[model samples]
Target: MTTRTILAAAALALVPALASAECGWEKRINANTCGEGQTFDTATGTCVDQSTS
Candidate 1:
């Protein structure tokens, strides 16, 4: 009925969505697509250069 009441309702509606958020790297990483001299790094979720002599 009042401004404060409406805002409270809106905030409560958003609580569930905020709580269900996914915290991590991208959904999936296709390591097979890495470059010839590179490899996928799980820790950083990226392709990195492979060490060689």
Candidate 2:
């Protein structure tokens, strides 16, 4: 491919990295203590889990 074509392709490839998408997570724990399996909730900011106790 030509130099310009290659450069353009490279720039387009970086579009996804610049996206707002992020590895979201949530804390699923009780107010007293965090006792649960933390998981990724993309919906929120952090991972969530089932609180116990």
Candidate 3:
């Protein structure tokens, strides 16, 4: 393949790989919830306290 053709194909392949990730959260809430210092959990699908662990 020509050099230009190879470069074009490479750029096209990277377009989708660098695209933004979706919501990333496992769930969503309806009403205004989460107390003064809490947040939603993305893995277990619940709202709970924030922890670095």
Top candidate, metric TM-score: 1
Candidate 3 lDDT, 1-53, residue by residue in tens = 99999999999998876663435443456325666557867666556876867
Cα error, residue 28 of model 2, in Å, equals 17
- Stretches of candidate 3 off by over 4 Å are 21-33, 36-53
Q: What is the C-alpha lDDT of each candidate?
A: 0.84, 0.62, 0.69
TM-score of 3: 0.40
Question: For each candidate, how many residue pairs have backbone atoms clashing (under 3 Å)?
Answer: 0, 6, 0
TM-score of each: 0.42, 0.36, 0.40
* RMSD, every candidate, angstroms: 4.8, 8.0, 8.1
Cα lDDT for residue 31, candidate 2: 40
lDDT of 1 by residue, 1-53 (tens): 99999999999999987777754434666588788999999899888999897
Q: Rank the candidates by TM-score, best first.
A: 1, 3, 2
Q: Where is model 1 poorest over a 10-residue stretch in terms of lDDT? A: 21-30
lDDT value, residue 12 of candidate 2: 97
